[model samples]
Target: MKKRVWRSGLMANQGFNFQKEHPGIALCGLDCYACPRYHTIGSSRCPGCAGKYFSEKHPSCGFISCAFKHGRLESCGLCPEIDTCNRITRLKTVIKDQPGYPSYQNRIANLIKIKGTGFEAFADTCIHKEALLKTLIDKYNDGRKKAFYCRAVQLLPLPDLENLLDENAKKGYKSVDDAALAVSNSLKELANKLGIEVC
Candidate 1:
């Protein structure tokens, strides 16, 4: 049998339609756009789980193959076997030790949020949040703060994030480094209040 190759896009133009097509949601409910890898520019960029680039890279990934091809589900949350799926359980175990990756608990929470809000609404929210996160990164990120900022954005509510952005904007810092320092300090405090560590 010939190999079944799923090619979505090629290099350079890959993931161009990522926002419109996938809105960053993975089959397993991870927000691909919010991930650090997805934000990276150039050849190392990830097109997200719904992007063609992801299919090209992880064509046979268990979540993609099982949910889309076999289970015929959009997200694992829609599957009756989601709770009992060995794959999910195994993945959860694997990600636990991986720093900077979303914990299994975070994935489950995102799934529940998506199930409650519907795909379009969830995608819209993700897009909006991603924009806010990008602003935070662009304005406030030092070279070492990307992961910390991403984690802070993921943990905080949209309104809070927006408020922080607005507040930070009004501070009139002297330099990009100054803005980054202040934002980083404020985000660290906010993260502490939310019971999340931004390190």
Candidate 2:
């Protein structure tokens, strides 16, 4: 039996559609685009799960390798066997109650959204959140607030998140430190009002 190649290599050899289908979402439904590492520059930057250079960055990501085994599927959520999959069970156990980066908590929600709205729509939603997250990173990252910022954008509604970002932009700041603190506080207040706990 011939070995089956997947992702970028397969895209080059076979015009694989999975790589292009919804680029930033992982097979297990993590929002790669919202991750701080995805926003980092230089060699440390992650290209998102199953994203370009992903094979180089995370060649052993179990879910991606699993998708390769499962007929080149784009997302595990699309798999018929998702409900019974031990991998997802493991994932839920692993991501539970981590102190920071609550964005990872969105994994199951992202999968459910993918199941409900399809990949294209889910991609659009991720893209919108990515743009918002980039703005937060570019303007308000105090070198310590990236995780909170990521969680805020992931957990908050787009219009509300965007509104807070815009509101923060118009405020005067004595320094970037002040600006970063204000942005964190603003998002925190919004998070509190929504009962979402972005911290």
Candidate 3:
């Protein structure tokens, strides 16, 4: 498989690394590239699960310590015991119980996709997702809506997000605040129509 490594967009030193591991895709299947923490400007940012200084920038995670760090694999889905992994099963159970955290819900399916397509191909999709998120962070972010934009980009389909952005681009805004509000409303409307939980 071809390694579709990409340079970081808005976050060159922030995250989106391509050193030896894929910073976009996590071992547990979180889209780290689309995470709010990855886009944080003021606070100390999360450099992604596999990003540079990952062990230093972020807290010590059980998932990494237990499985990921011991091997060279980019994801737990590559493990032979993925189907019988107790930690992953429990993690999925926790995710299922958390209705407020919609992003976590995508992890299991993402892991399965990694298993089928391999890390490189699955990460190709993640790079595209990150690109969409990067566009929002770079243009639409009004210093406060980073998290909201991240959630919207993560939950919504790529085509839907692309179309929404294209539609919004044709409109005029008075200021950064106006631009933010306009996109916010549009994103909410899209979320409602799609029955997507973006909080």
| Best-performing candidate as measured by TM-score | 3
- Give the C-alpha lDDT of model 1: 0.70
Q: List the residue pairs that clash in candidate 3.
A: none
Q: What lDDT does the true structure give each of the candidates?
A: 0.70, 0.76, 0.76
Q: For model 1, how does the per-residue alpha-carbon lDDT over 16-125 read when each residue is reduced to its tens digit? A: 32222563777777777677877887888887775655655554455655665443455666676867899778767866676655533477777766677676777777
lDDT of 3 by residue, 1-199 (tens): 1333333232333322223367667788888887888777654887777677776676556566545334656788888888998989998898878765555878899889888988788787678878878887887878888888888887888888889988888888888888888898899999999998676
Per-candidate clashes come to 0, 0, 0
Return the lDDT, model 3, position 124: 77
TM-score of 1: 0.76
Compute each candidate's TM-score over C-alphas: 0.76, 0.79, 0.80
Model 2 misplaced stretches (Cα beyond 4 Å) = 1-21, 69-71, 92-100
Model 1 stretches astray by more than 4 angstroms = 1-20, 70-73, 92-100, 103-105
Considering only N, C-alpha and C atoms within 3 Å, which residue pairs clash in candidate 2? Answer: none
